[model samples]
Target: MAFDPDAKLSDVLAGGYDLNNRLQALLISRPLDSRGQEAAMAFSQELSRVFMLSLSMLNSNAVAPEVRSGNSSGVSAPAKDKRARSDNGEVVTPSKKSREEGVTRKEITPSPHKDGYQWRKYGQKKIQNCSFSRYYFKCNRHRRCEAKKKVQQQDGGRGRLPPMFKVTYVNEHTCHELRAHDDAAARMASPWTASRHHALDGVVDTARGGGGLFDLLPHIVGGGSAEENEAMVSCLAAVVSGSVPSPPPRSSGWPAAPEASASDPAASFVPPAAAGRSASVADDGAMMMVDDTGVSWDPWWSFCPVEEAAGHQLVTNQNHHRDMHMDDAGGFADAVWPEHACGAWRRA
Candidate 1:
């Protein structure tokens, strides 16, 4: 079926506006890709403009003042110096200045128009006898682009009630900043672009299954508590320090430290001590304590950044009977705290 172009088209224009509003709402409501959102916003803006232009042409007020005056006086005015005089006598195109791109007035709905361009609101004033106030705006996204608009709430229009407005634009936009902003938005959202670089790994981790944006929803949406956050941090720290086994072996270049058995605490850590002086004060102003037990543990082992010692495991050994062991060097090996070695060190 086709609409009769010659028939009265108010119903058609009204239906188009209804569709435009729905399209705008759909674009804003969904969790689509940012690039798609950008395109949707552009499409909505253009469609709205088309509808506005159509409505303007159908309105009686859009007729030229010269023609209105000529008809009233029964004499046609000369097209000499008046703005936008056409070569033919039928239509006139008005220009305020060489730089101005004429004027455009369109009825728009869903208050605080989201026409996809940023504007700086400069002024607002109530017209002398009118109840509604007019707002002036300038789109100053770029230093060279000087586009401006004036908006006032429409008084009892034929469409949606209360929030509709007549937006008048004095110049066209020259700033290509909309495209730039769209690109920047898309870049920020790049993580959700594809499985190749999903949000979970910054690039996908197929070995464990594609853990994209969903893997982070709990953390991102703040469902986890503060303790959970701390636990996560501790877990990562333990992995880095070889205290706990690392997460499933990733393609990430850093190899996972060997998981050491904590059940055999005796074989895990044995610190017989270095052949240096007894448990006296160290030259670094650190005081040491010797438990009656032969096994000594370093409190720092749980979080130390020793790449070479990644093979070492966190030995939370509570056994006081185990004998100390030494590294390849005669010095005792540095391992973590046992269950009872809490008071081993005093701050120097």
Candidate 2:
């Protein structure tokens, strides 16, 4: 589990490690019944819908949403269906020259350095069964900071490109400085988040409710029962669901990250949604399995500027996905506000 922006620092410092353990357990530990599957599908749809909408919004701001925009502007859209969407909901035009067939090297290009560490390219390699070249870079600073960056072009066949760049920091000043910077920036982002965190701390003190941590205490110190676990999940689901009374409003300052714009050469590889029906259950199930396998709940908190921007963008894509997928059972692909339409989500 990731830290919530609205959680207190002291609370995090005290019980943070336990949270991760619980999250891991929750991910792989299947639910006793269809409840887990239902919850997972619901959760997956919500996440995918938000992601799709956000990509569209971001894409619209930077690139054209449809071919009509390209035609009106006298620029031709790319000739292939290998288009990807953005967190802002725009079409990403892939470069025909970026990838070759049957290559196996993928690169993780670092985002433009948020902190001040310059890098120099060192080498390139080809991996097996992938279709791109991976470029490697190292921090050139003599200050004992070892940061590495990997750059790869998009594979043309997947239709959606994986993240084009991945930056891994070595055992020195690499991520520490970057995380500290993010810490400071998050602290300064908004006073409301800070106040909310403080309030959450107060709630923990008064309520003594066990969220994910309740399960582990039994083995460590022998504390609770199965009922406690159920209560905790229900409580957390309620609380997390409560935090966002409504989706966030739009903001300036490019709410999404990495200076997203259509004109950028690297935009094509960022994975966004397509304009067809949502990915099928097999695909969604795989995505959910991947999500559970990864077990990174950091996005659950983290005041992600990108996620907020994506939430705004998703409003449109959710509608489209829902419309396209309505005929299916469970109707899990659609993003309908339960209170507004289905009357399922009662406000806390």
Candidate 3:
């Protein structure tokens, strides 16, 4: 079979148009359930459509000789309705290079700094009716590159919503040195990707009425039953009120300081004073101990039993017999202790 160039080009163009339509359909359906995928597909479809249209225009005999010959003077002829005109009524021949390189406008949400392209601020101007100023930036990658963009902040009256930025790109990027770096940075800075929280087993609860410190307390405490949690809360309440009870005496056979590992379940029941540290319980039942310099240590994995005599001595030294009451103003300074001293009892 003899090959025909015209027939081959026509077939390729038709196939390209068909593929573009199929991609458009896929984007409309949103099979991947991702806006990034849809945007990429839409851009690709548009590029394909433009390429096919340009090829079709080139193949036509109706194309003016001036346009085919790349003559700027003849390109402004009355035959081409698409040609723009200057203020002086002279026919303006639009930049052929810019026409070939399509322009795209993207509305970036939250911020414009994540566009991944290095832009140099050229100018700024205030627009009518808008509270924010419009900033003009030009691509600094190449001196000849004509790419420019205008960035303007979208006004959010009450700040109840995130601010938006309108970025109008005039020309295409021709720099290749930092293209990959910018793409990676944009992906990293994407709100969708950055907003994802790490999933931990039994740590986060998305269900209704599952908020607050109580939901997270169980996981932080290394898992405990309802009864154990209640008991822990009661113990914490006593500690906060300066009324902690003395632990029962251990047998003489037991070591002077019992070396209990953090993994030991019984270690959670121990008081921090037994480990030679000043202990305090937070409102949410988290136990914390302060060092000499007032640095609080996490109480979750630091429980250890103190000798009965030592525990009683430590409690007697720290506890003050004062009436504790919750104030209406929520100030704890007058409630049996100074506000600053209750560091261990405050919410993190």
Candidate 4:
């Protein structure tokens, strides 16, 4: 390859068939009307200028696209010229997982909840390979609220559309209160959201990890069992009591609970009516009578902060940053509303 020392850096970058060059071309080379050429060129130059400035400040440790060139091997080039497979075979798909490591793609399905804003469904789109229809909702509360949500039907595994769904909220809305209201309104609009509430009345359980985002598909298609129901109740109780199962004791001079080596009768007082009190609590909590017959199950572990228990399996650590939207209006108002002993609580 011949080098052109006097050429602009933008021209040099775009001349090579590498990821960086491809990206620059895609972002800067949009089709413009004949009269719009000057405006487009100015915009492209500005974007390139910004990119150059940012590149100078970044360390080599930053993840930038690896550049490569390919001759006519008859293989079609990737459609979007943004990213390419690295020489070391790193493939970057712009959907779903790009949200990992601090890059936010606003095009994803938005979170189902917003803090206090309301919205109404204005359209629905049928995307291929998506089992459920995508329902679109725009903020009905404030013109200032430019938030939208896409609701997709979750596949119900047995060739059916589960009464559950995956809701994505694409929000750039400034009105935090309206955002919250829109979140609550979305829940009210979706029938799948309603089913989750109904399911919880008999059995409410979920799992989560570091981020507040959860995968709820597991329980959606899989029907609940008697043992699962009992587990659900126990899990809820754990959260309420503020004691996630004390992580299995680590080896060391870990002190066990102090016991009565009782020469003193006062240290170990026996309750005269312990049996009656325990029964009454159980009776009150076990109102939704589903049969516990012929169901055997294995126990599973998850982290559920009482604060973040509205959705599925989630693990909690102080370092984990929950979505600001989740905290905006007490996540999933439908699930948390009218707090009663729905099931046992599990706390992480």
Give the per-residue Cα lDDT of candidate 4 at 188.
83
lDDT tens digits by residue: candidate 2, 1-348: 344545443334334323333333445666536776665555555445444444444335442243222232222446456565443578876455333311122213322222223344456566454454455545443223444544443343121112233333332334335444544576699755655433422333223344446545444422222322333445456688885122221123111211222112132222221101122122122221112122212222112222232343345345433333121111221121111111111223
| Deviation from native of the Cα of residue 330 in model 3, angstroms | 40
If ranked by lDDT, best first, what sequence of candidates would result?
3, 1, 2, 4
How many times do residue backbones clash in model 4?
37
Q: Kindly report which residue stretches of model 3 are placed more than 4 angstroms away from their true locations once superposed.
A: 1-102, 177-348
Model 1, 1-348: lDDT tens digits are 234555444454544545455554555456768887776777566676656555554563454453233322222345465554332464554544733655533334323233323455567666665445676766544445567666665444322222334555666666555434544567677745533322322222221223543345334422222222333555567877879532333124211111111111111122212111123332332333343344333322322222112223224343432443322110112232122111212223
lDDT of 4: 0.32
Ten-residue stretch with the least lDDT total in model 3: 328-337
Query: Model 2 lDDT vs. the true structure?
Result: 0.34
lDDT of 3 by residue, 56-99 (tens): 65456353232233221212223446564432468877687657
Provide C-alpha RMSD values for all models, in order.
31.8, 21.9, 30.5, 28.0
lDDT of each: 0.39, 0.34, 0.41, 0.32
How many residue pairs clash in each candidate at the backbone level?
Answer: 3, 30, 0, 37
For model 4, how does the per-residue alpha-carbon lDDT over 87-193 read when each residue is reduced to its tens digit? 25787654554333222122211123221223455666666766444666554435566565555544431211112334445544444465345556766898566
Model 3 residue 41 distance off true place after TM-score fit, in angstroms? 39
Model 4 alpha-carbon drift over 4 Å, by segment: 1-117, 156-166, 176-348
